[model samples]
Target: MALRESPESPTPRRPVSPAPVELASPAPTRHGTAALVSAAAGVLLAVLWSFEFVDSVIGDTVANNLLGHDAKATAIGGTGAGLLFAFVSGFAGTFTACNIAMVASVGPLSQAGASNRLRHHLRSLLRPVGWLALGMVAVSATYGAVGVLIGDGLPQLSTDTVGGMPVRLIQSSVVFGVIGLVLALLGLSALGLVPDVFARRPVARVVLIGALIGGFLIGRPYPLFNKLFHWAVETGNPVYGAAAFTLQSLGNIVIVTLLFVVVVLVTRGGFLRWMTDPARSALVTGTLLVALGVFTVVYWDLRVPSIFGVGWFPTMPYN
Candidate 1:
């Protein structure tokens, strides 16, 4: 009995375990990410397209007419033409050549599981983009100044206005040719499927040469470029303008496609991972893009009044 009782006596013991550690997680992707990117991209495209139109038309006119008749004046009027040339030369030229930026800023938010990689890509592109932006502004400013000057003077676009035959003639002819080339190239480039080596590197050279050639073509028959210009301006319908803008933006879409590849290469995993977690991805993407859209409006509000000397858009000011 005693032995059985002793053997039966056993003690109850508890097992110990370590506490789980918590980590800070990224925000979830909400459903609105794609919409936000699309919207923001649309706005950006609109702004860029407006400038491009000006650049394509005006730059061609001025550079072409630098040795010819005052076709630039006839084609676009005075300040309008100046603005146009400025748009093409400054905004048009670079905008088409360098839209990888949108992808840099937005691709991470759009793609899945690639936030960190996207960020790195963006960082790599930042310097180039900033330089491009700065160059665009400078070129735009120069184009504007020249346009304004010529607008006031109504200088006959030819070698005499630009310089001598050796340098000026060659330069002017080259400019016209180049612009024509860019317009033609733009038609194809707008498809946006070109390889990066071609897209990023070759485009600038192409545009430079094309600008000269295109400028010559448009200058030769200022009436032709003007017809398109007239169509664009005669229509007060903002929708038509917007449509035109959208059509023009097809180039941007192509440019963006090229950049998208770069973004994909750069932002490898984070974006995809984020995409898997749609909730947080949407939230981040939506919030940032919406903010960017709002900022665009605000920027337009501040900029238009100062530049245009009026307040036309209180609602959708940027458009």
Candidate 2:
């Protein structure tokens, strides 16, 4: 207790002000720019896939491998044949522009997946898929039934053309346009650039995505689907249509589902946790949504329209 010790009660130190959060963060800018570029790349990829060289080669090749060369003839044998065709065709379409966007679901699925003991993880895998299938089945069954009743009256099955553009292609443009916008917006939302509509509504989101997958049939122009449509009409049975379409939707999801399972099994659910982690979830989910979403929009709307001179998409030399 020296007198010196009491002489100067040290002046209270000023609390340091936390470093200024740059009011204008570069983060948003970087994200926005990356998003734009990703979107552009999506469009380009859509164009590439649209070109005859790529589309005909990949889509047709896949279909041939899956259903043999008789895509149209193969479905004509009877109800069993038609149903089988519906499924095989849907499955084969996994790479086509109309259906490829379905792949975007992988992002949400990955984000939703949770890790646990392998037994629990394996069992848990199907829950999200079941939810997805529920959504898909509803749309597909309804559309299939109604499509039979409506026949060519449905724009998706129209034989008519407008302004020299096949009405079927026009339907593709409209349907995929909406779906793509939805996916892209979802990506933006995940990236924190928009309201998080599905943050608390994860189940609904999955269902909606499933519904979108089902909706793919609404715009699908594959030969087998077209064949199935006519078959359902000829049979005069909505039940047939509904059943076949449900199967088709289920088939459409089979490969992607398997891939999801493989990822979970191989990684022991770690990939999903890594993806869904708060830090990386948004980035991964957003990128997938934006890319696939933009691909859907461009492949259908822009690329298809270009054929009618509504716009121009680059053509590869081989085509």
Candidate 3:
């Protein structure tokens, strides 16, 4: 009897842990490294977007003192163009960096998980990466185009002699906000992060709230999008006005960052998991896309004069 009781089926040997996934163990492909670096830069810009108070004050000062009044609005228009340039360029860089990072992280893991055919696994990754890259480019380009439209609209808005620094700052902010979103989306896709379902609703609400706050700070009438343009008319020093606009621009950056962070964190478990899980991930991605589109449309048409008012922050020498 004692002999019969001996083995106890050896506890049915616990299943062995799955083999570790192989990342891109070989030297990173040029494309993959580029993606990683670009994503890092994108992250940095996202952080810069968070500080509203300081930027606004500086903007106000620049608008009032540098560009002076009437020409201020035109300068703001130009600033928006500047931002569009910065954003699109940055977005391109980030996408490349992120793609590299994904290969470095996932390629190796896949190899470790299954040693058979490494090249095949990596080749499969290319499609998703391409899709992500294309998305990034499209979104950023759209944002820049919208900025152009808004910049063109500046002259008709108001006859005030305020600074252009404020206007420029505002235009820059709008471009940055939209461009930031594109970068964020690409980063998420490259990292194989979650799609964003769990946090989509909350993140969307936050974006909306942030937009409202930015509008209020600038003295735009609440509610209707067009009503907010009047805030471009400043009451105090040109610097103060520019500073206000800068701060308002910063507010938008902050909102985008918050949403980006939420998506990144949720997907941190694994980019593939997020991508594969349509229900959760798709919802998040879809919401972000929708939010971005709406913001672009509304913000672009809101007011052309306020951007020129940014001139109050930076006075024009020729004037």
Highest-lDDT candidate:
2
lDDT of each: 0.35, 0.78, 0.33
Model 2 misses residue 183 by how many Å?
1.0
lDDT of 1 at 182: 37
| Candidates sorted on lDDT, descending | 2, 1, 3
The TM-score values for the models, in the order shown, are 0.29, 0.87, 0.25
> Which candidate model has the greater TM-score, 1 or 3?
1
Question: Which stretches of candidate 1 lie above 4 Å from their native place?
Answer: 1-247, 266-270, 308-319
Tens-digit lDDT string for candidate 1 (199-268): 3342242323222322222222123332333444444343333333232223223344346446545655
Q: Write one digit per residue (lDDT tens) for candidate 2, span 1-319.
A: 5555454688678999999776886656766776787798798787566444334565456666876665754546788877877787777667777778788788777665644334678666887788889999999999989887887678876789898998988888888899899989988887778888887666677788899999988888766567777888778788999988998898889889999889877987777667656646667777778989998887788778987988897766544
lDDT of 3 at 299: 32
Superposed by TM-score, candidate 2 places the C-alpha of residue 281 at a distance from the truth, in angstroms, of 1.3
Cα-lDDT of candidate 2: 0.78
lDDT of candidate 1 vs native? 0.35
lDDT of model 3, residue 60: 35
